[model samples]
Target: MQVEVISSVNEACSGKLQHRTAIVVDVLRATTTIATALAAGASCVIPAETVQDAKQLTKEGDLAGGDRFCRQISGFSYGNSPGQYRGKQIEGKRIILTTSNGTRALCKAMRADHIIAASLLNAEACAQLAWELRRDVVILCAGSRDSFALEDGLCAGLLVHCLRQHDRSGMLQVDDFGSAMEALYRNKANVIMETLAQSQTGKKLLRLGQREDIVSCSQINVLQAVPYLNGGSLIQRLPGTIAQTAAPLC
Candidate 1:
């Protein structure tokens, strides 16, 4: 397997993304929010790069939602918070979402053969899909404001850790940066809370009084909802996945 990490949306746009499986990580919120919505039984999640594009897709009564710079848009029903999606009403509903960075990364990575939203909420499932597909993989981190964000990198590293743990063949080749990310995850797995609380994006959220989102996004392996892009929208692939409430990481 050949695996690499694209540290920011700019890098994703500049990369040759064809014939690859992209695991998009926006751990501060976007990817985490998608996972929770899918786990709550949303029919599909449509990612848009702009607020106009997100609103235009409401033809089928798709719920328009998103945020820009940590502030919810004025007309949207919900912001980019994981807690907002853990509801029974979300079932059978399609969400048209746009975000400051995460959705833009997703749009940039659209050329890949497969695109999946991932976070600590569904790290193992994302890894399992990557191994099963056996495609060239790109762990694309949705960095904030065209620069790197620690939480996304940490989640990418978590995916790398799980992939390495599951692969006994020792044949997978990871680039130096990927290896360093994996090492970072291995070394700091015990201090996830502090690590997240002190991260740049996390601090921004903290200032906005959105502390619950930080805590909610920190839990690991709690959701089986793997949100994969299919036909311009992301839907949960839950054929035989475990259905249960999310739990905190160890």
Candidate 2:
């Protein structure tokens, strides 16, 4: 039940996460979008590290979505906005997704014992899942480029808080990044939304007139699904079900 937070994919690779449960966070949009999409009934999501890869998947007849910074790609069917997933007929469909930071972080965690994608949208669910597993956990934040993002850090803090509540013994270990995130959570109430409106990436979205996207991504725990990478596709773990199906790669 040790807990640690890595600021980026690079930091995660430098540590030992092979036997640990990995939680990938990209609160600015990507992970948030995935959680929202799955909650809205998407069958599965295929996360690609690059927009080019996502486009290629789409050209091969995959249902693809693309986002760089914040705006939609030229030929993408959907942008990275969580609001676009509601009531859509995504059930049993494969979503080829690419994003600025989150996808890369997810790819890096693919080798972990258990990899779960997290965001403000599914923070509590993810934390609860991690606690249930009772494994050492690494919270990886997909920061902008190689730098830290405040929104992701805040989400990590919320997760840490949740996990601590579930197990308050000395079993939980907090790293430097985790401590910083907890501090941010103490001072900044609802900072994920505010940071997105003012962050470098968030400002780019605003310039693109995607204020609605920021608002959508900023909403916390709106989804109950915990998306995990299984056999290379993102699938939701349904509650009360000991068995699950792996999403086929398109």
Candidate 3:
């Protein structure tokens, strides 16, 4: 199997992800928040490309959550922080989420055979699922403001590393950018939290008094909840929940 890493959402095109398993990473908060919300027992997450779209998608029982420039959208139920979703309030409720970069990246990956919301929190589970699906993979980093974000790149690198670990044949081919990301992961694996704290986005979060969020998103392989896109919603699944045999998109 082959794996390609997209540096940022702006660099991702649907054509590259056709018939492939796409793993969208936004570790600074978006994908991490999705996985956290699912692990916390939310029913499903619907990613929207815009705040207007997110508002429109919300029904009476649904919750609208998103952020712009790292601040909560006015009048939304919640912001993009994972901590906000870690409670009983989200149980059995649908989250209509839109973000500046992450949700846009998810929508950009809609052409893939399977789309999985990924972050450092669930990298191992996502790799295992992608390996089982037996499709070439594309890891799209939801960078901040159309530019590459260090935290997202680190998570993509972690995904690349995890995917290679599951390659039984040892023939997994990774693109040049993916290889570079793998190197980045190896070099900073020991100081992940520190690295995140030093990143540009990290500094911004700190200025906004969100240091806890950076700590939460930097943990590697801490969660098994994989947010698999089923139609317009992302439903939670575990590593072994999917059949090993290749199946059509549900």
Off by over 4 Å in 1: 238-250
Best by TM-score, which number? 3
Clashing pairs in 3: none
Candidate 2 lDDT, tens digit per residue, 149-244? 877888899898878877755567788879888888767765667876877777887888888888987887777789988987889974334334
Over 137-198, each residue of candidate 1 has an lDDT whose tens digit, in order, gives 89999999999999988898999998887679887788887888888888879988778889
Candidate 3 per-residue lDDT, tens place, 93-183, comes to 8999999899999999999999999999999999999888888999999998899999988988988999888877777999999999999
Q: Which residue pairs collide, candidate 2? A: none
**Model 3 per-residue lDDT at 171:** 79
Model 2 residue 29 CA deviation in Å: 0.7
Q: Give the TM-score of candidate 2.
A: 0.89
**Full ranking by lDDT:** 3, 1, 2
Which residue pairs overlap in candidate 1's backbone? none
Cα miss at 123, model 2 (Å)?
0.4
lDDT for model 3, on a 0 to 1 scale?
Answer: 0.91
- Tell me the TM-score of each prediction against the true structure: 0.93, 0.89, 0.97
In model 2, the worst 10-residue window by lDDT is 241-250
